[model samples]
Target: MAEHTIHFGILGCASIARRNSRAIKLAPNCSISALGSRSLERAKKFAKENEYPAYVKLYGSYEEVLDDPNVDVVYVPLPTSLHVKWAVLAAQKKKHVLLEKPVALNLKDLDVILEACEANGVQYMDGTMWMHHPRTPKMREFLSDSHQFGKLKAIHSVFSYNAGEDFLKNDIRVQPDLDALGALGDSGWYCIRAILWATDYEMPKTVTALREPEFNEAGVILSCGASLSWEDGKLATFYCSFLTNLSMDISALGTKGNLRVHDFVVPYQDHVGRFYVTSDLGWAGIPEGADPPPTVHSIETDLPHEAHMVAEFSKLVENIKSNGGAPETKWASISRKTQIVVDAVIASIAKGFEPIEIN
Candidate 1:
């Protein structure tokens, strides 16, 4: 750890793994040392197509990646169904884990994976890029300001994309066995995380799924919405779908202010991210002279949000390896809280759209 960069071994040739591989290349403290897939040809093709260095090892089985003595971290971008098994195995092998979301099938499964990471003293983090975005903290800073933005009142989030007929039919995301949570797990995971983040990770008191969720054949969700409320009257609603055009929106209202972000999941441009904020509304009516426009805050970054996420996670791993430090529990807790809300929403829908109390 003193003078060596952390080595990453990706356990799957999934589409998302390509992005993580690129991020590792961008991270100063990390390098992609190996690639693994069920088919050795697929792994070799991925490595060649991605222009990995000649030194990068290719493995036919994921377990080989876990067994590699030089692999310091295992990036598991496999489907939700495969997450628990490979992620747990990687942790048990004493390798840090960077897992893709919808971390597991449910909280019980998620807890088991988390316990494995804890027992092995390895860091656990979901590949949620926005949490590492520079603009996210700027929005939070405004939300936390009492004089500018008072108590949070409500939040509305939407994330969706038109996946078309072919993807709907063949994509693993919409397949019941591959990802039973479907749209709720794919798009809705970010919505739930955004809401929980804006609330400072406070668990909602109750979660109610909106009526009339759309589903594909084989009983997988295609689109769904949910409402969450707190004891103090704070409320949040989120919509996620595979049927709509690409859109990611967040509208947050406070007693004295409002915040809006059109692209919260992935920014329109990787280098620059922007959000709108309006504060201290003296009166609902027109202002004294020409009404002032809402403040537009722009944050510039050298790397994309996903790359930042990789860098942040790599730094944590380095700390543990170099300083003999314990794994940070904050990232794991955030992933768990997001999964908890996701579970409640799914439960509500299954139980006739009835309100499910968040336990």
Candidate 2:
């Protein structure tokens, strides 16, 4: 590996890893140097199918990936339950960690992962792909504009995908042991992160899970919704499921304006993204005609959002390795806030849909 390049070792062969593998390849200073899975044959197959270099190392266990001296970073695409285990181990091994979203089953486990990374002087980041998209900053710019957007009044986010019979019956997301949080952890993670992003990571004063979350026979969530309220009376609501038509949206309403994004979680395409905004929206000519249509803004990116995430993470790793820079805490902070809200939502559901206060 070149001195400036950050070598990445993948810890799982989950379906999401394929997209991440391509992203690693797309990043300028990163390489997918190794892959590890419980089944060596599966690891080998993943390498071949993903078109990784012939020299890429394949190991039979995740620990070996962390043990590799050449690996400067480890990407954990494991299930939520396994995150703290593998992510902490990788951090203890002095390898920077890029973990998949829903950083853990709860905030306590997320803290364990964060502490390990901090103690080991390794960078930590969650794999929230949309956060690295160029469109995000543009949207934030509009939301922060006092004259155009005024004060935020409400936020509504929804993310869902209709899982077919095979997925509903066999997917790990609906399994009790593999992904216990189910749709809440898988789909709702994005919704919560979107809400947090729009609100600049402010913690809501209380969170209440909507009544009657749909669950499978194993008692895993298949669909759910929640409402969050801030101390200043700002409100946000989110819905997530595995039983609806594919949709990813975030609509933020303010006193003077509103913003709408149809593809906030994953864009319609990799190269370009779009969003709409209507500022100072009101009646014109005594309700005879409304103001002009919402302005549509499109952003074009040379690399995919996942690739941008990889590149950003790798840059931090490179800085720490070569320049003796301290690990960036911003990503870890955001992950913690997201997990806190997720835990509150779970608590509310367990308490029979009562609001859970956040401290």
Candidate 3:
């Protein structure tokens, strides 16, 4: 009830929301004020299992959460198909929105959500938790160092997890109506975002999907890859899947240096994250010696990246509520750029793996 605190209403009881609820609790200025789902009983069970504070309100429908006068922010972990609908409604109701990644099925839908937030003066941020990790900025510092990293020439990102039989057959990600984009939206999102982050959000000139994406019977992507080319000869490739081993890697090669991270999407450890950098010399003589081993950089955090994300978002929400500040545009812009690239990937796949211009 503090003036600077943010009251968050969770729009669903999805599996991801449980992790987000923990984040809300850890965020300094945020509290889980309400929980809502299609089924009231399910919502109650989720609230109970998550150990939400007794003060948390439970609602039978998402509308009730948006209608609550006390809820200052709405966290949307709903399906991709429902994101624009509920997110726009939440924004229109003057609730700041913390939406899950792949912000929408396509850029068009994401734009609608963004426009609503802008019109309503509500803060909007996607659930790309890695962006808040301290290690990310440190990596960016290395990438931007011309003397160390030089000009970025190429990058590759991979993110995958073996979903097993039940997931491929029963999960919402593989369902056509619920999350038709499947692995591309669910997993590839991080890969695309990482690529964009490495390039400072400079969109690629064109995107071409790798041939033959694996698809379920419902025609949802289970695995796919794509190549992106920038105007200045910078190139990037990314692979994502729900049918492979757990692997998350990003290799960014520059003219003079290279950066590699095995856990770009999610770190193995919650408190500390690491990335490697190799700079200056390469191709060592056989007898002389190779460049020194890639220097390992680890960042320590008091809270998990997800909690950091929530805290950062809540700070913005609090500023708008207490200081009458305009909604921050940086987060919305990044979400828009990420979705644009995702749309291009989808378009290229649909067009028989031809290159799609990123106009």
Candidate 4:
């Protein structure tokens, strides 16, 4: 390894690169050293606008950036369909990768990414930032071992936002050939990831889906509903939509009580209120508001940062430096499973909501 900071390179000038570029500049051990794009003018323009260091090279072609001997890691923010190709090339170039989410369109592409990373002795991590947010683990901790929620019987979750006619009017998210998994792949993946994380369920035994026609062009499922099971009797339901205004909600039902998280998706603003439950005295709030029993403990915490991407990126770099690999098995496994469930759901919808086994 080089003695100076881990010299980084960016593969595209997408909006996401703008966000991660901030973190790259701030982190002590990382620096964006190169910018690559299909267009030379665009590459130079992005580099100039971002004010990357003077020595940071700009390249007309992605290959030029990867071919550069000094670039150590490549941050890929390409469209979902393009992720696998560049990721494989990055790995083949012996560069570490922080790939954008949906990791790839399907399992085959994901496998290629994994193989490329392994072959080149480089590390790879999907940019599914929400999975690494401290808020999620905190939420899980609060729910565990609690009579307030008894034993969780079922979980229902929803995450959606109207991308509006503007996106459909121009963006590839609405293009049929490009919109393989539909909005579900783009935004709904989180809803699936969060629910599976909270319940710690194995791959859903079966998946069914419902999606609107407009999503055919969006490269995502505009709206979807899926049901999943863990063991013999545990069941869960999840939904995601792009046709409606934004929402982030989750409800965990229990034998004795339930827990609901309002605006749980983005975690950008300060959220109050307790994890409410039905109690002996009637309904009561716990955590940030209302009164609670001595036996019922409440937790008050905030999901800081306007975005969780930086936090996860920081953790990813630190973990690789210290532990020589990605996060624990449960975390990595959940990421793969997240993609798996989305794939199954899309397949089901293609077959008219026919149930598909996850395996």
Candidate 5:
């Protein structure tokens, strides 16, 4: 363990927070300093349930966590609506923020959070665990190799899982006031991020919601998809749903090659990741075994991706605290681009599935 460990304070007891709590503990340079909720008893119960150390503080309100001098970072797993409020305040308090995904309900609110973090010199990172995985960079190396991958042409991504009836009816994700973007905000965030990442965060020329998006009685999205195109002839499409079997994938095709990954969001198993790539395509099979085969590449890591995210965040915080370094803005910038596309998707759907121009 590092001598200068950073303390993490959680501001909510959301189920996702439970997963992150474990991750924070798994990180060598991070430790849970506090857990806060609307109910002190709830915090106590959660601390016990999660087997947190007895020395960890418990608070009845989120403000207490922000006010704690021992806390160096705040992990906010609150709903989308509350993100703007808590995330901005955490930044203003000069605590780095690790926020849950679907960064905000809209780009405007997201900008507010980003501005706060920038103004306060606090790092801001959305909870996209896969971004910290070693395998992601390995895949990126291939995508960036023009000689092998050539000019990128198209990309397809899908992230979906069957939310049980209870979840569909009662989950905050399905509620407009809590998580207005719903399925698009929840799952589609990953799809959009994947596409933007593959394109080096280039803004799409246009975004068109494909077909129709299903909505619940409250007008929250349940399933949605969108297509994005660029002037360079690069195109991408993604689908996200709360009404499908478990599936997470990304397939990108270039003029000279292509790559595919079945579990891009979360690996099928912890600590191990895999992707396939094939480069060569003048024509189809010319004879028996004539076509090239995809090379299977797999990476095994010491810790799960979530824990890796925590360790990476901690390293950045350590640099800022110990070496007088500025916070890394790349994470927040990527998140903003992802949210821009997300807002475009919402607009396209609102206009009756018309194409929404991206500026």
Candidate 6:
């Protein structure tokens, strides 16, 4: 914390890495000190294109990046399957880790990554950037206000995309080794996370899953629904899919009012949109215009680097510098629970739509 800057290394040259690289550059007191890729030419090219400093090294192997003494932290933006392996290796070297989302393919791998971090006394965290956004903080605060949404009633969330066959053909997101990435993990996780995040993971005492298997190809889930406990005496329904055209929306209903957010997942560069709300009193619109409304804020730039990657990586740096590091909380717990729901959906499909309750 004493220094004005922190040196870091990137472990992959994928598109995710490119976004994280730009975020680190933008974050105060953080810098990409090195980069590594499986291909020597790729590593060199990436380093040159980014104008990484002379001290910033380029390595053909990720291990070399981990071994760099100048590298205080490691950003692993590799495939979903490789997340656990690289996290463990970086932790072994006593390097703080900024791991990509989903943490790992399953809970077992997530435990190992956490164990490695604990054993090595290094910080490790999954980068759920949206959860760290200023709006997220505001959402939490608003949800607590009695007049904001009144007593909770039910909630619904949706996140869908038409990832054409071309993407599935070559992307690891669709590989069997990667757990047949489909609606469940590919885009569905966003919906699950949103529910847990919005509700503070307070509901969902028991979850029953149902999947529309026809939307799945190669055994990957395409559409899913879950019956969850919305409140003490109420229940909520959830839905997500990746086979649809495109949709990203969330709604939380209550006795007094309701909050509906449209295009929630990825807002535009200008963040211009209308989030509608209705109550017994009347209807109102919270428009994100040149200036965002209260409780809603836009990223600092019109560029792509303004993505959630900034908030995600910044949290890693802040935790690493805080000595004992940030305390683990419902965030980690809810992610594990969400994965269980995904598994339950898979089980339901295998059982001919027989609903399975999440333990």
| Pairs with steric clashes in candidate 3 | none
Residues forming the 10-long window of minimal summed lDDT in candidate 2: 283-292
lDDT of 5 by residue, 294-357 (tens): 7889989888899999999999999999999999999988999999899999988889888989
lDDT string, candidate 1, 198-252, tens digits: 9999999999999999998788999999999999999999999999999899889
Residue-by-residue lDDT tens digits, candidate 2, 242-345:
99999999999999999999998889999998999998866662354644668899999999999999999999988899999999999999999999999999
Q: Please give the distance, in angstroms, between residue 8's alpha carbon in candidate 5 and its true position after superposition.
A: 0.5
lDDT value, candidate 2, whole model: 0.92
* TM-score against native, each model: 0.97, 0.97, 0.97, 0.81, 0.96, 0.83
lDDT of 6 at 347: 68
CA-RMSD of model 3: 1.8
lDDT of each: 0.91, 0.92, 0.92, 0.68, 0.92, 0.67
Better structure of 3 and 4 per lDDT? 3
Scored against the true structure, residue 298 in model 3 reaches a CA lDDT of 91
Tens-digit per-residue lDDT, 186-205, candidate 3: 99999999999999999999
Model 1 gets an lDDT of 0.91
Question: What residue runs in model 1 are displaced by over 4 Å at the alpha carbon?
Answer: 1-4, 282-292
Q: Can you tell me which runs of candidate 4 are displaced by over 4 Å?
A: 1-4, 27-29, 211-220, 270-332
Give the lDDT of residue 277 in candidate 3: 86
lDDT of model 5, residue 310? 94
